[model samples]
Target: MADYPRHPDREEARLDMSISQVWAAERISCPHRDILRAYLAGGLEAAAQDYVAFHLEVIRCPFCLANLEDLDAATSAEKEELRQRLGRAADRTVSSSAVFLERLRDSGAGG
Candidate 1:
């Protein structure tokens, strides 16, 4: 059996009794779920969006399409939840001049 969760809407779904079941996720190989989410969020660059578009629209990757659909169908609460999750994942980088000066001095350059 495939360890990865298959898309219910995929061709194989015809054989799956869970076809009528509504799932929140799908297991796919290409254009990882994150990329799909980023694509829907419009966070991806033009080229990246183009690639995902090709994968979902042209390649017809059911799993990714399903993810995209889910993202598109997200409610206000769901969108807020996702926004919070992304906010928590952000990096806190300090780019103060003191930090740069210290780095410069360590590198034998004038601070």
Candidate 2:
């Protein structure tokens, strides 16, 4: 083999993704984070619920997986804070899980 000019940047870019990520990305049509968050909270509508299920079961998008992990890791304090922000005392129309994300977005919390 002959020595050739090497650009480490190009080489790094070519090798960036782990095999798992590449495989997952190939299959996943990842929905938006907010939508994923809503899905994680079990608040998505029927159509969105189907999409999320497909992503999780088939594509297994890593980002949504991480977001779901975060939601599962939510502390009691965090849940209480979300409930307070949504006025759980007075507003009993919706389940907290159903509204926590929307309230977080409205409060400039980036959901």
Candidate 3:
């Protein structure tokens, strides 16, 4: 079972990596999420003076940035709904496949 969250609308919600989400953040230290919020809100310079390496790496990762944009686009309720549906689908697939394999073994048809 895959533990990472998956979103079907990810491609649709993707945003280009702006300079705010990329450079100009390496010299400011802060929590990644906070830095992102601050950057979005025109407060990038207020992050800190120690330089945020990990946060900049996150911003530079295209996949991570796309997921972050998807998150930003979703309302709390919509995000929760998606999470619940994916979890339930994964659980159902796992359980059904296990039962089918067990039945196959009992019937002497297991691969």
Candidate 4:
């Protein structure tokens, strides 16, 4: 019989690899974008938040993280665009009101 040298951490490494594989497999079942968005907004219930936290922190699912990041960025961009649009509208309204008031005063209708 031949003597074989055994690595002491071989079993532990195999277990770790299997655990990682399991987590990777779970990625396919990641939560939807709505849930992820709610998680980002702190709008989810405690239990749902915990699950999302585990999926993100423990499982480290890249797809969900990327989706969350994209949603957040899009949200910020939408907000900025809305703000700019409102500002432009307000400017136009103010200009129109000023013109109307000036014409009224010039036509002796300001009394």
Candidate 5:
């Protein structure tokens, strides 16, 4: 077996995705956090192609699709705030589900 040297400084370069492409990727509700994740995770070309299609503003309107870049710039506190918001949303959803289940039980529609 042969061993190869690895360089710790060798980090992958970032691709310049358009705002609209990022927006579409986001609006489409992909599982990953953002297109950058896809790019870094070995789908560089796919991510680039997605943005390239919208670079000319042909696919998505740039005016409405802007701000994707800034979406991930939150500080620790800001992230905490967002986490709290998501928690609240989840709590509300759970409460609603519980209420519905209770109603179903009351109506003898559930076991």
Candidate 6:
């Protein structure tokens, strides 16, 4: 075989590839969104919750952490929106009741 010059960064590239492969494997093992959501909601069983906690706290998987953060934010926003909607509905109900009561009084129905 003819001798060829080796690239100086070949080892570094190989190391980077190895690291990427490990990262890909870890990501593949990550729990799906539904499981993550259950974990967030405290709906998972003890064993499943423990596993998720280990993955998040010990492994510190960046992707899962980001997903969890996104889920939390979305949940908070939804709750706030629902609260505002309920508040508006309550205000409308109160206003309507007041108007009805005023009309009743004006018509001498309260006597």
Write the residue-wise lDDT of candidate 1 on 1-111 in tens digits.
Answer: 669976667667564434223221343336777788788778999999998887677556677777778767774569799888777655323345668778889999874
- Please, what are the lDDT tens digits per residue for candidate 5 over residues 1-111? 899875444331122334435756665433333553443244558667466445425544443234333343433457799999999999999999999999999999897
TM-score of each: 0.42, 0.43, 0.33, 0.64, 0.34, 0.66
Query: Which numbered prediction scores highest in lDDT against the true structure?
Result: 6
User: Candidate 6, residues 1-111: lDDT per residue as tens digits?
Assistant: 999887669887887677656865768668999999999999999999998998788667789999999999988899999999999999999999999999999999986
Q: Ten consecutive residues with minimal summed lDDT in candidate 5?
A: 10-19
Across 1-111, the per-residue lDDT of candidate 4 in tens digits comes to 999887679897898678768767766658899999889889999999999998888777888888888999988898999999999999999999999999999999896
Cα lDDT tens digits, model 3, 1-111, are: 779765556543454234445443443323566555444445556434224334446444444455456546654567789999999999999999999999999999886
lDDT score of model 6? 0.88
Candidate 5 accuracy as lDDT: 0.55
lDDT of 4: 0.87
Total clashing pairs for each candidate: 0, 0, 0, 0, 0, 0
Local error of candidate 3 at residue 97 (angstroms): 0.4
Error of 1 at 72 (Å): 2.4
Candidate 1 vs 3: which has more TM-score = 1
- The most accurate candidate by TM-score is 6
Q: After aligning candidate 3 to the native by TM-score, how far in Å is the CA of 87 from where it should be? A: 0.1
- The weakest ten consecutive residues by lDDT in model 3 span 47-56
Best-to-worst order by lDDT is 6, 4, 2, 1, 3, 5
Screening candidate 5 with a backbone cut-off below 3 angstroms (N, C-alpha, C), the clashing residue pairs are none
Name the lDDT value of residue 31 in candidate 6: 90
